[model samples]
Target: MTNRRSFLKGLGALPASTMLASETGFAQGIERDHFSDIGVKPFINAAAAYSALGGRNMWPKVVEAMEYARERNVIMEELQDAVGKRLASLIGCEAAMVTGGATSSMTLGTAACITGTNEELIRQVPDLRGMKNEVIIQKSHRYSYDHGVRSAGVQLIEVETAEELERAIGDKTAMLFFFFLNDAKGQIKLREFAALGKKHGIPTLIDGSNSVPPLSRLSEYLDAGFDLAAFSGGKGLRGPYSSGMLLGRKDLIEAARLNNSPHADTVGRAMKVSKEELLGMLAAVEFSLSFDYSVENVRETRIVHLIADKLSVYKNITTKVSYPRTESGRPHLQIFWDKSLTPLTVEQAQKELEDGEPSIRTCYLALSDGELEVGAAMLKDDEVDMLVQRLGQVLAPRAG
Candidate 1:
């Protein structure tokens, strides 16, 4: 889970009035909205799972669970135990801990892997002056999010080859970290990486944050023998945006929790996973696990086909429907346009969609490869029509 720091307006500290603004303050009221009075109306999400597009929507059950947890007040420690145990069971892990978000989990998980449940070490995080604080990561696995590991006070050692990775692991090597999104770039595969970590007696952690939605991936890392893994509760899971889960060996997860909520002075003190978000995450996990993938695929395919057919007449454009897998478990549609026909670049098309009657978000990937790819996983029943209509508007003939 990513640590969501509330925006402090002018003074470093938020005024009490600002914090008490509205239930929807987290979702809207920025100065950029041209749709309606910024605070009074909701903005349409056309950008798909971008954090700026409000990440992902919470499942209705998650919202209800949050409300249920909010209405009652209990000792937070007990709440943590129950929520953690249930979450661990649902994810098929020995234990689990909810943090501010996936990045918080990454930071706390890294700290716990290095420092264990030691109180002295827990308080000295992001500054391991006299501890084993080196983490081995593939050079290809480097990303902006790796800052989470650094935030834990660990130094990242970049390795590209299997031999380099092996040599990089030493007594000071606290963790072997892998970013699931960069699996294609890394030389170490999951099973091989896990084996290497086991051989060296080092902890292995895989950041599977945006890699969810396919469901089986919930257990895939564990099954692959990873010692610890972090996932975004908000992304594919459709839980609260502020919640995320750290799943791993019982000891490590417990240590992670020790450094998290219901406790202060630890590195993760400020990264609290509220009781409401915890409950909502549990409900979201249950709902996601219970969903039928095959049936969902059929529906997703029908939607993809409908969009593909609707735009088939435009000879200048080309559309091929394919099942693309994201961090989320299920496969969704990837719609790409032929860039050769007209000068309507991907960016222009995206902006056009965004500026339309109902703003729509589409995927944008910049690769040396030919055209741009847009995934359809984030679209809803009504948004599907909106997408088709908007595409037609942009691709139609120009007036003389």
Candidate 2:
């Protein structure tokens, strides 16, 4: 609903730097195929941190830290331990460890609760013989990522109501897992879920990832009584693709480290995180902590509004720059069209964008009639123009 002039305030100061500037400078130079050498093609990201798009861009500080780390020699164990302490301090947690993404954090955290620094037990995982193998999870919260906990060799017990949760927890329950992102959809609320874990004396865990601006939710779970938590380092943190942050109690964090890389013959050995990823995660956390997220939300909002302003000329198209009330705090552009007024179909427009020369990706939702949602979080300032141009070309009516 924003008018063109009303949305033009922050537009002038917006940076127009290329999105792939750093990535373009490959080791072999311009003509050399960096990504294409392996038959991979690059595209502009108008979407959020979708894993298929290789996560978000790394923070410049993160990149610098990684480059500096690549030239130095330090003990892997020592580096992980130090980075964990620093990150914990930055995130307001008792302890934290850099993991191999959120799923890896789930696996490691599950392993920590199951084994807890026991070398023999660490070796005996994915085969939870003579162990408390059941992990209680909300029925609504049960999804693909639960497999991460399962990888640590735990059976998931799904529940819906408060009564069902209490009844589900028994002698075999190792930990109570909650998906923080899906809290609104679950019957058991955050405080209630944490209270449930506290009541049962069972350690609680949460997938506290995908938090956009105002990242106070990072520590909110632990403060609410969760014993351990995992957040994506690559998503909002803008770190290396393979990295994640695990925050929780010192004992659990120490145990998680034992069960992760630099230690062979463990379930998490395969989920190895490199030194570069470790430093990248550390720098990303630092950047997030020091950076003012308020400005970021405004920048994202302005970017989306810019797209909306450009699309305002279309006859049947209505573009609203909005921030999902209960979901991601970042601003996004939602475009709805009156199909009778325009010949373009939602799928057709989406396909054309994806299949075009400078391929642009957007969230294509079939939310009745004709609609599309495009996230502005990962858009480089320059890509905003390309997205608007491509979208205009796709949605514009054919000439007579």
Candidate 3:
């Protein structure tokens, strides 16, 4: 295992500017004591919390928000309620609530759908000894995160198509759940799914943790009639990585709150959000909405173009721009390579890049025809130059 402490030293000396920075600066000011004393070393955060990539770096604004909240204390419940109300207004939902993260929101939301605001039943979740424990989920929508819902103690009945989903709903079906990313795999769309739940008077829920890039995705499900929806705070939103939001119908959201934090003796109590995290996440939401995605794209395009311009000297390489789907506009980048001309494989190139001086973290995507895709999102100002230099050296004619 990599001794992360040693890695910090390898980044050379911490910059003087960092000396003045605060301890709660990691991932938007969550006050990471572990890293605060150690701080960030020099590694490209390409993996972006993919779990495989070790997640992403925190946004500075998020850190500031966390720090601001830490200074004073307020009633945690009141703070969450106020934040939820503000978030509801912002997202055009009937109500909203923050949770530990996207998964927490899912578990809590499912639990609420299972018990509503009933005190006795809420505490008896997952026991299901004598309750409506079934949750209707499409066969195609079963993803890793479904465990969160199932963790609430509901039995998940998998189905496909409108007919199957409708049939699955009954006295035991407490909620109909949808994983947004799997929309492509499912035959039913949000409107159809929501309608099925509505027809039966059952609540409909959606897990949209990674769906924010399109930007409008935030409002898409709400407008489509999902009774409850959850999204991540860390990734594109730049909030605390450990935080997320659950938003939807007022009564449902309220029920979710009663089942969750700032209180006790329920499933969501263990996954509480600190006042700092709550405020910081809200600030991140505001900042994310206010960001000029188009300008950010233009900036990305320039960096990618620069890298491509330098790499163009090599033969058998072609560079093309790639864009991420997002409401803020999307990330712009350049993809370089032509298999016939280069003797190296994409994996070999990736290894070479990761092994080079100053080290470079490039995003890789495999094509149907076997090509490597790279981007400019996580590169620092100096790292960009290092990237071009290393790629040039690695691709240059090698001696026998």
Give the best candidate by TM-score.
2
Can you write out model 2's per-residue Cα lDDT over 184-275, one digit (the tens) per residue? 99999988998999898999999877764456767777878889988888877788988888889999889899898889888889989888
Q: Candidate 3's residue-wise lDDT over 78-171, tens digit each? A: 8988998777666656788888888999999999988889989888876888888999888998877899999899889988878887777778
Candidate 3 pairs with clashing backbones: 27-58, 28-62, 28-63, 29-63, 47-53, 49-55, 139-159, 213-326, 214-327, 215-327
**Which run of 10 residues does model 2 get worst, by summed lDDT?**
1-10
Kindly provide the TM-score of model 3 when superposed on the true structure, using C-alpha atoms: 0.80
TM-score of candidate 1 against the unseen true structure: 0.84
Give the residue spans of candidate 1 off by over 4 A: 1-47, 327-341, 367-372, 397-400
lDDT of 1 by residue, 1-400 (tens): 2111211112133233432242245555457556564644443443346665677777666777899999999777887788888876666668887777889889988988888989998888767888998999999999888999898888999998889999888888999999887787678887888888989889999999987756667677877888888988887788999888888789998888888767778888889777888789888887666554455455556777777787777665567654443424333344455455445766787678777776666654432123334455556566666677777777655543
Candidate 3 residue spans exceeding 4 A from truth: 1-41, 46-61, 213-215, 324-329, 332-352, 364-371, 392-400
CA RMSD of each candidate after superposition? 9.7, 6.9, 9.4
Model 2 clash pairs are none
lDDT of each: 0.73, 0.79, 0.72
Candidate ranking (lDDT, best to worst): 2, 1, 3
Error of 3 at 124 (Å): 2.4
